[model samples]
Target: MKRSNCLIEVCEDFDCSSKRIKTSFIEGNNSSKMFRNTIWYRSLLDAEKSCLKEDKLKKIHYKFQDDKEMVEEYNVDTQVLLRRAWKVKGKLGGEGKWDVEIGDPMPDATPHIEGIGADFMESKDQPKLTRRNTRINLEWRIRNLPYPIETYSVSANNDERCIVIRTTNKKYFKRLQVPELDRLNLPIEQGNIQCSHSFNTLIIAYKKPQQLLDMDKEWYLELNRVKPIKDIPNDCKTQ
Candidate 1:
């Protein structure tokens, strides 16, 4: 999906002399849409110590001086990122349950199998998006799907700029957009879409265009030229 109102920015300048860092996001295009949270530390090493996910939460705790405040901040940031990255929400299947989707268990209940006597918690083998050398691939495991390979239909809808997957019996459906193609203003071609089913899993691949490949090459070359900063002290510790 194309998001015209939101943009993600990563700050590259980390100066220990400032003794602070910011994790911020901007909504809308103009100056009126800034959302920011600053984190201060005694030194760069102190800031670095909070780089880990767990440590970041602890740092948020210190910043807000309360657990509730920390939780609200974390939730807001998480939701924003998830909405931006995961344009497609959880899929529905088999009487309204997720067959191959991203989800969390109920708040008070454990993730247990329906007929496994509650001993086996559902495994988290969620659908994943991966990139091969020349293609973007999506893999979804729906172990309960008993349909034959002939029941599935996977097609690229150039008008919608998305790949659509559907079953003849209406047991499953998904609409997936290629972020790379959308960002580059490229059209989705029906000829680039491929699909296969194996071992109760559906795999779809979209061949990458030459423009994307060229962009990747240039990005790698630029990354190699970025030198690591060596002067930041490591002795300063965070409490």
Candidate 2:
């Protein structure tokens, strides 16, 4: 199936006093559909009682349900909601309401935690991931190669659930995993991977699978419908 290659703009307005948060999503393409299929659960057992649409989640829930020890071990409240598309850390309120608070705000009045990305690195030699808003393919740039296009090779190792980058001369080698796909229980398919070299940088582009696209669409819609909190104290407002 063809994927819908569109970027979503997510805006979050949170109120710490009320422990409430509002998330909004604006799609680049106006034709995007909005869904209201929000499911809430206090724990694994609670989620198992509901109708979950995702197969991976279903399998996990079933496994836990069938095992008495596992059920007892995971029956406690976690203050987090796991859905087919995304996980929301908060308390489920009445009906569709949800109370979300990441943590205490910093002196600058911003939350301590932010979102995740493929580009985050701890060292300078690591491959840098670049997410393009105009395209659906994810790009990873490895600099300081100083090698021609034919000197490098990139391929997917599905058994390991990662993509391997290697130099023909054995000078450099790196294994990069797509954590986002792992959350969705997707495998690394060779057909969706491509690479090239430009200005001593080896760039690998992975086309997003259709399941991920649909997950994004669902996640965006749920966040867009969240109501914004009002009467936030001045200290809670960002500086």
User: Quick one: best lDDT, which candidate?
Assistant: 2
Summarize candidate 1's per-residue lDDT along 42-145 as a digit string, tens digits.
21113212111232221111112221111111122221111111111234622122111222211333344576575455444544343223223223334444
- CA RMSD of each candidate after superposition: 18.7, 20.8
Candidate 2 local lDDT, 57-95, one digit each (tens): 221111233332111101013211231112223356322
Q: CA lDDT of 23 in candidate 2?
A: 24
**Candidate 1, after superposition: displacement of residue 214 in Å?**
0.9
Model 1, residue 233: C-alpha shift (Å) = 13
Candidate 1: give the clashing pairs.
none
